[model samples]
Target: MTLPLEEDSRPPYLQAAEVLRTEILVGDLAPGSRLPSARLLQARFGVSSSTVQNALRVL
Candidate 1:
């Protein structure tokens, strides 16, 4: 899937992880906030289940 960010060469999971990580680091995703479910993330990122899980694992 194509992401809004300009990173292209990375794996899907890594790409998703980088977006989430940046959001969290920049406080868009707060410390105590609950993240969306894996299924939701999968749908949102248009990626596979494994990719969503791998992205969550990066957090």
Candidate 2:
């Protein structure tokens, strides 16, 4: 699940959250499903743990 990070004014956390929210809305991520671990998310998104946490908060 490698998603390209867009170059825009939005913060990295918001961008990550948007990607995740889209997946949920599109049914790619089913309701009540377990989300990937923060470490995995950080590696996948090339972001820091804090960024992943912020993204999860947004979700």
Best by TM-score: 2
> Which clashing pairs does model 2 show?
none
Residues 1-59, candidate 1: write the lDDT tens digits.
Answer: 34654558788888999888988999988999998898888888888899889888877
Weakest 10 consecutive residues, lDDT, candidate 1? 1-10
Candidate 1 regions with alpha-carbon error over 4 angstroms:
1-7
Weakest 10 consecutive residues, lDDT, candidate 2? Answer: 1-10
Error of 2 at 37 (Å): 0.6
State the C-alpha lDDT per candidate.
Answer: 0.83, 0.88
Task: Tell how far residue 7 is off in model 1, in angstroms.
Answer: 6.0
